[model samples]
Target: MSNVLNTFLDENLQDLRTQGLYNEIDPVEGANGPIIQVAGKQLINLSSNNYLGLATNDELKKIAQNTIETYGVGAGAVRTINGTLDLHVKLEQTLAKFKGTEAAISYQSGFNCNMAAISAVMDKNDAILSDALNHASIIDGCRLSKAKIIPFAHADMDDLRAKAKQATESGLYNKVMVITDGVFSMDGDIAKLPEIVEIAKEFDLITYVDDAHGSGVTGKGAGTVKHFGLQNEIDFQIGTLSKAIGVVGGYVAGKKNLIDWLKVRSRPFLFSTALPPGDVAAITRAVEIIMESTELHDKLWDNGDYLKKGLIELGFNIGDSETPITPCIIGDEKLTQQFSKRLIEEGVYAKSIVFPTVPKGTGRVRNMPTAAHTKEMLDDALAIYAKVGRELGVIQ
Candidate 1:
């Protein structure tokens, strides 16, 4: 590599190290679930998005093994050609029913779905009205669309409405669309979909909801769109087979026409290899488990409430999180990174979100409480939080 490139990389890495923001990769030696082993230390994991704890479920694993035995490991090529396995078809069908949509299309990953779906339908003449706090995937997708992106405030329907009105009234764009994360992952806040839908209707804007964190965690596993009862109204319902679904890949659920169009135009779908058979089977089984009962969903909520209440009682600043994603709001970025490192050392693994992820001073340590956590596990984690909070002067 050239000295210029090496120098740039070294400087960036140095900057991160000097600020304690350089993240050292910790490999999970064993399966990742409610708890995981890192460097032989078993830590209570509070940073995974496996809200329903389906990732380690015995049923999901068995289904995956069985499917691998029957169908082998890979999908071989892009699905539009010859890579579409029977398992892939099954997974898509199951997802449509699970999401309460007419049809669906699966991609290599949730991020791929965003990249594919956004660019597939919209073009440069179109404008994307995005939530300022939408996920990175959505932002990347908007960029890929080659469309002018206008950002609205996080979950502020009034702002979204104003932006929608302004864009529609501008008469500059051939089309206008509104895209948001159904569940804002950072703040643990739910989007005001009902209001956004109403605004979209008023302006005739295309609606897209990436329910990556919402699926298998909300509406008893249906998702945020279904949570708000606006299934059919949302033009694109994007979701992931990772996270709560206990598998890999992503999907776009909506009317048949949208999916049909995506099949032809989405570059990721047309150019990328499809989801493997085992993953597809695993996700299909996950959907069955969610549809079978709400036991995991209830357990997830119970654990979330317990952890949130415990953290609050300790007087640590947990931001206004409405879901299982609990954030200990540490304003200073350096201190936030230190707090996360200290938590890991204390056998509680969590991540620090710093500038460029959230805001400059609004740094936080976000926790994801899964259905697999017990009260004792949660209590032990909370005790560690209290100890760390007091030691760091984060709480009295």
Candidate 2:
């Protein structure tokens, strides 16, 4: 090993410690949607991203088990090889029908979808216009594309339009693509897809919308593209099976030709192993549930509204969030972590998000109240929040 490696590692660790950004992981032993086991105690969970409360769903579990029995435990090769199983085919077709797209392609995870999709299409001679606050996977994907990434203000379509005009009119590259998250994870705000679609059409920009946070939460379960009623206009609509769908995988829904291109070109798809039979089957079942009933979706929105109202009434600054992802905004990083620790100690399981994830000063405990959370559960969690908030002087 290089002798200088120790110096570099130590310096980085020191910097993180100086900035109060060192992380300590917490282990959750069991889950029952709104509540989970942590540190040998049951706590009301408000930090899980399981929006539909489908992660431990019995129906999904049965479907997954059935698939495993039929197809065995794994797909042993990459999709480009013989690894693409009958279940994978079924999942893709189900996704296409669910999203109302011409076709769909599956990936191991949502992060890989971004990495695969961006690089599969754009390259060094191209330019990409991205939302300033896009997810880390998108950032990495854009860099991998070798495209010159120009960040427009987050959800500011006017700024995006300006950049699109310049990029297209200037004719400076082989292609120009505009990418954004359907729902911003941190602030929990939605993207202006209508405006983005309009700009894309006018400027002939390739449009990509990552719906990881929007897939099951919006569009009555279709996604943000449909929520804005722009399904036909958006070029690439990416979604996660993990968050709202309550499984593990990602997908790209778009025109047949576009998907066909990705199947052959995306490195992750061609290089990585296919998703396990169980995960794909469970996700397929989730799609069926969402398409057939709106009960879970309704309950989720209800819980979100209930939680948001309670938090606001307590006089804590909860940031502007249109979706179920709520953040109790506490400004200092150290204090935010302390608040989260206190919340856990008080029998609530919410996690703190500090600097780098959100802006430097806007540290917060991001609460994710799922549809599985009952009214009584929310009440208990709220009582704990009130007690903790006062004890820590976070609120008056």
Candidate 3:
């Protein structure tokens, strides 16, 4: 390696270590479930995005196995070539129905979905008004579009309205779009979509919502857009099959013309190999399961409320989370890392989240309470938290 590259790497590595911001990954021994085995230790898991416990659901596993046996492992080619299988078609149809859209298109992963969808629609001729705290994917996508990106304060509807008015009335761009995450994962706050929609209508701005964290958790499992009954009002409804759906892929659900355009113009769909047949089949069934009943959704909320209440009673700052995603805020970066490390040592697997995932001095241990967690498991985890918090002087 070149001396300059080596020096850059060494300096950055030492800087991260000194700041306690370098994250060391732990390998889970088996399936990621309510209880996970990490480094040969059994720990109650509060770090997984398996919101409905469908990642380990027996029925979905069986479906995947059976489909793989019939269709083989891979999708063979890109969708524009020969990779579009019957299962892929079925999955898109199911996603459209699930999202209450006229049509839908699937991609390899949620991150790629954003990269493809955003650039496909908005371009240098357009301007985008994005939420300040959106996921990194959205930020990158906006950058890729070459569109003028104007950021609004997180969930500040008045700020969004003002920006929309300025961008749309300026006549400097052909179009202006407003985009946000359906659920703010770090603090677990629901986006003010209803108010956003109202602003969009006033300024005739195109609306885009990435509900990666909200689908199958809110709106009776349909998503945040449906939760507000604004399916027709929003132009782009983006989601991930990996998180709440407990599978691996991403999709855009919207009107038929938008779906048609994405199919042709979205680079990921046109270039990347399609999602595997087995995964596609499993995703379809998972959507059906979520749509069929709200049993898992109700249980997930129950667990979230239980855990939040416990943490609040024990004097922890959980922020204002409206969904099952919870965060235990520890303002100091080193202390937050120490708290998470102690939790792992004490047999709880919640991980520390710090900059640049979140702003500096707002480090947190983000907890994801799923439908799979039992009361006993939550009680045990809460006890461990109390012990750790007291030991760290984070609580009385």
Across 170-271, the per-residue lDDT of candidate 1 in tens digits comes to 999999999999888888989888889899899999999999989988887788899888998999999988898877889999999989999999999999
Model 1 TM-score on a 0 to 1 scale: 0.98
Q: Could you give candidate 2's per-residue lDDT for residues 1-396 as a string of tens digits?
A: 676998898999999877768777888886657778977998999988899999989999898899889888899899989999888898899999888899999998999999999999999999999999999999999999999999999888789989999988886799999999999998889999888888999988999999999998988877899998887898898998889989888999999999999999999999999999888889888988999998999999999999999999998888889998989999898888889999999899898998788789999999999999999999998999999999989998
Instruction: List where candidate 3 sits over 4 angstroms from the true fold.
Output: none
What TM-score fits each model?
Answer: 0.98, 0.97, 0.99
Candidate 1, clashing residue pairs? none
Error of 3 at 61 (Å): 0.7
Clashing pairs in 2: none
Candidate 2, residue 56: how far the Cα is off, in Å: 0.6
Q: By TM-score, who's the top model here?
A: 3
Point out where model 1 deviates above 4 Å: none
Query: lDDT per model, in order?
Result: 0.90, 0.91, 0.95
Worst 10 residues of 1 by lDDT: 16-25
